[model samples]
Target chain A: MKNFWVTLGALVAVGLAVALACYRWHCDEPLHAAARQRDALAWLTAEYHLRPEQAAAIGRLHAAYALRCAEHCMAIGEARGAVAQAEREGRPASELAAARDRVAARERVCREAIELHLREVASQMSPEDGARYLGEFLPRVAAYRHEGAPTVRLNQ
Target chain B: MMNHTNDPFSEALADWRVNPPRDPSFRAGVWARVEALRREPWAAYVRRHALTSGLALLAVVAVGGWVGMRQAHARADRDRALLVQVYLSEIDSRLVATDGTP
Candidate 1:
C-alpha cells in the first residue's frame, strides 16, 4: 500500500511537471510572429522604389506565404497523425509509407513556393532598391537591428 | 695588429657605464610637463567634446542594453531550439526504451 501511494504521488508530480514543461516551452506563437514581422518589414523596405500597386502586390504575396506555411504545418500533422494511427492499429507498412511521402511532397512544395515568391519580390524591385535590400534592409529588420544602429553622441 | 691590447671587453664595459647627460634641462622639461598637467584638469580638455560623464554613462548603458537584448534574444533562440530538441529527444528515448518505436 505504501509503495502504491508513493508511486501514485510520483506519477502525479511527474504529470504536473510535464504539463508545466510544455507550457513553458511553448514559444511557437511569439517566435513565429516575430519572424513574420521581420519578413514584412523586409518586404516594405525592399519595395520603396516601386509603385504603391507593386508594393500592395507584395503584401498580397506575404499573405499567401503565411497561408502556405499553415498548410505545410497541417500536412505534417496529417502525416504524423496517420502514422500514429497506423501504429495503433498495426496497419500495413506501405500505407504508412505513402502517408509520409505525401507529407514530404507538401513540404517540398511549400519551400518551392516560398522561393518563387522571393523571386517575384525581387523582380518587381528596381536595381537600386535591390541593392538597398542587400546593403541595409536585410540587416535592419532584425529583432535588434544591429547593422543599422545609429552612431551615438554624448550631447545628442 | 697591436697584440698588447689591454682587456678590450673591460674597456667596452667602461665606455657603456659612462654617466648620462649633465645638463638639467631634460629633468626640468619633465617637471615642466608635470606642472602643465597639474595646472589643467582633464575635465576642461575633455569638455571640448561637450560630453558629460553622466551622458556618456547613459549612452553606454543604452547601447549596452541594446546589445544585451540582442544577446538575450540570440540566447533565447538557442535555448528555445535546444528545449524543443531536448523534448523531442526525451520522447524518442522513452519510446525506444519501451520498444514502442514501431
Candidate 2:
C-alpha cells in the first residue's frame, strides 16, 4: 500500500512537471514582457523595433500631440457644456444646433490631429514597419467615437 | 489368542491387507492449488503489468501537458490583446470622450 501511494505520488509529480514545462514553452514571452511594461513609449519602442533616433522623434511627436490633444479635449468639453446649457435654458433650436456643431467640430479636429500624428510616427519607422503600424492603428482612428481613449475592440 | 488362529474369522482377519491406487501428480496438484489461492500485493500486480501501467501514465501526462499549453497560449493571447488596447488608449484620447454625446 505504501509503495502504491509512492508510485501514485511520483506519477502526479511527473504530470505536474510536464504541465508546467508545456505552459512555459507555449507562453509568449515577448508579449508577456510588453504587457508588464507600464510605459506606452517603451512598449512601442520594443514592439515596433524602433531605432534610437526613431524613438526620439516619435517621443517628441507624442509630446507635442499630447498637448494638442489636451487642448482639443478642453475645447470639446466646453462645447459639450455649452450644448447642455443651451438645452437646460430652453435656448432656440439654432443656438442648440450651433453648440452641437461646435462639439462635433472639436471632435473632428482632435481626430484629424491624432490621425496626422499617427501617420507622422509611422513615417519614422522602416517603410514596411510603418505600413504595418498604420495598418494596425488607422482603423481605430477612423472608428473613434470620441467616447474616451481609443481601444481595440477584440469583439469587433 | 492361544487358539483363535485356527478359527475362520481369525484366519480371515489375519489374511486382510490394505491397497490403494497411485497418483504420480497428486503432490504437484496440491501445490498448484495453494499457489492459485495466494493473494497478490497491489504493488506486485502493478509491476507485473508495468507496460500497460506505463502507457497509461504517459497518456495522462501527455494530455495534461497539452491542455496546459493550450490554456497558457490562450491566456497569453488575451493579455497581449489587452495590453495593445491599453497602449492604444493611452496614445489616442478620442475613444474615451468625456461627454456621453459624441
Candidate 3:
C-alpha cells in the first residue's frame, strides 16, 4: 500500500510537469516572441514578407508621419476640450454646435492624413500585398472614433 | 462368545444411527464460493503488477499531453497574428502613444 501511494504520487507529479512544459513551449511561446519584437514595423515586415529595402522605405515614411500624427492628435484634443467646456458652461446652442463641428472637422482631417499615410506605406509593399494592406486598413481609418488608439481584440 | 444377543448394551449400540437434513444446492454453493476466492481484486492486481500499470499510465499521460500541446500551439499562432495586427494599429493611429505620452 505504501509503495502504491508513492507510485501514484510520482505519476501525478509527472503529469503536472508535462502540462507545464506544454503550456510554456506551445501555448506561451508565440506570444512571447511577439512581445520580444521591437515594434509594429518589425511585425509588418514579418507579416507582409517585405523586402529589406521596402521595410526601410516604410520605416522612413512612418517616422515622418509620426510627428504629423501627434500634431493632429493635439488639435483633436483641443477641439474636444472646447466642446466639453462649452457644454459645461451651458453655452448657447449655436456655440455648442460650432464647437462640435470643430471637433468633427479635426477628426476628419486626422482621418484623411492617416489614410494618405497608409497609402504611402502600402505603396512600399508588393502590389498584391499593398492592395491587401489598404483593404484591411482603409475601413478602419474611416470608422475610427478618435477615442483612443485602435486595437485588435484577440478574444474576438 | 461374549457378543450374544442377550446383551442389551450391544443391542442399543447397534440401533444408534443419524439422518442429516437434505440440501440439493450445497455442492453448487460451495463451488461458487471457490470461484470467488480464486479471482483477484483489481486493486491488488494493479499493486502486484505496479511496473506494468505505471508504464501504461505514463503512456496515456504522454499521449494526452502531446495532443494538448498541439492545440495550444495552433491557438498561439492565431494569437500571434492578432498581436501583430494590434501592434501596427496602435503605432499607426498615434491617438494613444505607445511611448506612454499623451
Winning model by TM-score: 2
For candidate 2, write residues B33-95 as lDDT tens digits. 667535556677578769977996998799879978998988776665666577666655554
Q: Write the per-residue lDDT of candidate 3 for residues A1-156, one digit (tens) a residue.
A: 454565677667777677667766666642545545535676677667799999999989988988887887778778777877888889999999998888778777877888898899998999999998888778766766332433425335
Model 3 alpha-carbon drift over 4 Å, by segment? A24-38, A126-139, A145-156, B1-94, B97-102
The lDDT-based order of candidates, best leading, equals 2, 3, 1
Q: Write the per-residue lDDT of candidate 1 for residues A77-111, one digit (tens) a residue.
A: 66566667777888788987886676556545544
Best by lDDT: 2
TM-score of each: 0.35, 0.68, 0.57
RMSD of 3: 12.8
A1-74: candidate 2 lDDT, tens digit per residue: 55567667877888888888899888877667766664567767876889999999999998888788777777
TM-score for candidate 1: 0.35
* Model 2 local distance difference test score: 0.76
- Determine which window of 10 residues in candidate 3 chain A has minimal summed lDDT: A146-155
Error of 3 at A12 (Å): 3.1
Per-residue lDDT of B58 in model 1? 54
Q: How high is the CA lDDT of each candidate model?
A: 0.49, 0.76, 0.71
Candidate 1 achieves a global lDDT of: 0.49
Question: What are the iRMS values of all candidates?
Answer: 22.6, 4.0, 6.1
